[model samples]
Target: MTAFQPDLSSALAGSACLGAWAHDPASDRIALSPVLARLLAVPAEAATGTSLTLALAAVEAEDAVRVAGVLRAAGEDGRPFEAEFRTRPGPDGARWLRLMGRCGRDPATGAVTTQGLAFDLTEGRRPVGSDAQQAQRQVNRLADHAAAMKGLVAGLRNPPLARLVDEVAVEVGHELARHLRGGGRQVH
Candidate 1:
């Protein structure tokens, strides 16, 4: 039999970066991934106590109510949900996030908790297969670019340019990682 080979480009393009979260209402405790903490611009340790509030804080004011309602309904009925909403950052900022989650009641504690994955959708991209491959390749190219940019910035004494390069490197790295991890279908 021939060896099985997964299509890397298509697989990456269709993938998402999933950050898992668990929130217990009774104890008001929350557990979140570092990715989620970074996306929300909250301290990783701070998220354990009030994750829901911090997560909601990132939602755009107008979309907050709708997103909240969906989450609320899911908790009440024990159904899973997925929502893509904009975040309130700045006039020029794009802080879109998609949350897919479900609510469950513990058998022992009888406490209801909501748990699921969060995806950063700020780029609003469903990458074409070729684009995905190109992106992967681009990330490889960036390894060299990062080094060159660091040297150039040092020589030119340009802080802004260095920041821009750093941001791009981070964004590409994150996207590539997310695409590789977000492989499965929406959670049921």
Candidate 2:
């Protein structure tokens, strides 16, 4: 499939925080621009061939499911969607990102696809550490684990094996989230 490279210069007016992405449901593949891959903590080599699950793995645990649901709904219904979510804590700490996209059929193959842009919203904010941040850091480790599993899953040629790995990763992520939520504190 051809890469989706939407004209982003005019849209962002030279903003460094802008990035582009496209998803093809038929192949369950996602293509992320180099800038977006870096922003999402995805390795540059794997960005173009990654899956949606892998892409979402970089999102903060609290926002991953909501973001996935929104994207899935838009893909199924051909509607536009916009979501603002936080990335997992990193060297720069957790940062906010806004994703906007719509579904359309590829003219050549009639395959349904979604293309969009992500804009970093934490440009001016300074990173800080707090109890909540610490807690999120712990949760983000789980996300990192899931991401690693997703990378392995992508390499499996066997459908069953890949599915098993994917399921395990998802279950582990859910369990981690549950354990964190059981703690007496919450982060908004």
| Most accurate candidate by TM-score | 2
Which regions of candidate 1 deviate over 4 angstroms?
1-14, 27-30, 90-92, 126-188
Error of 1 at 117 (Å): 0.7
Q: CA lDDT of each candidate?
A: 0.68, 0.77
Give the TM-score comparing model 2 with the true structure, all chains together.
Answer: 0.58
Candidate 2 residue pairs in backbone clash: none
Q: Could you tell me which 10 consecutive residues in candidate 2 have the lowest summed lDDT?
A: 1-10
Q: Which parts of model 2 have CA positions greater than 4 angstroms off?
A: 1-11, 14-17, 124-188
- For each candidate in turn, the TM-score is 0.53, 0.58
- What lDDT is reached at residue 185 by model 1? 36
lDDT of 1 by residue, 1-188 (tens): 21487775555346555467776655545676786666666677776656466666766776877876777777788888787787666443657778888999989988899788887775544354676575665556566667666765777777888788888767656655655655333222
lDDT of 2 by residue, 65-142 (tens): 998777778789998878889998877678888889999988998889988987777763444687666556666766
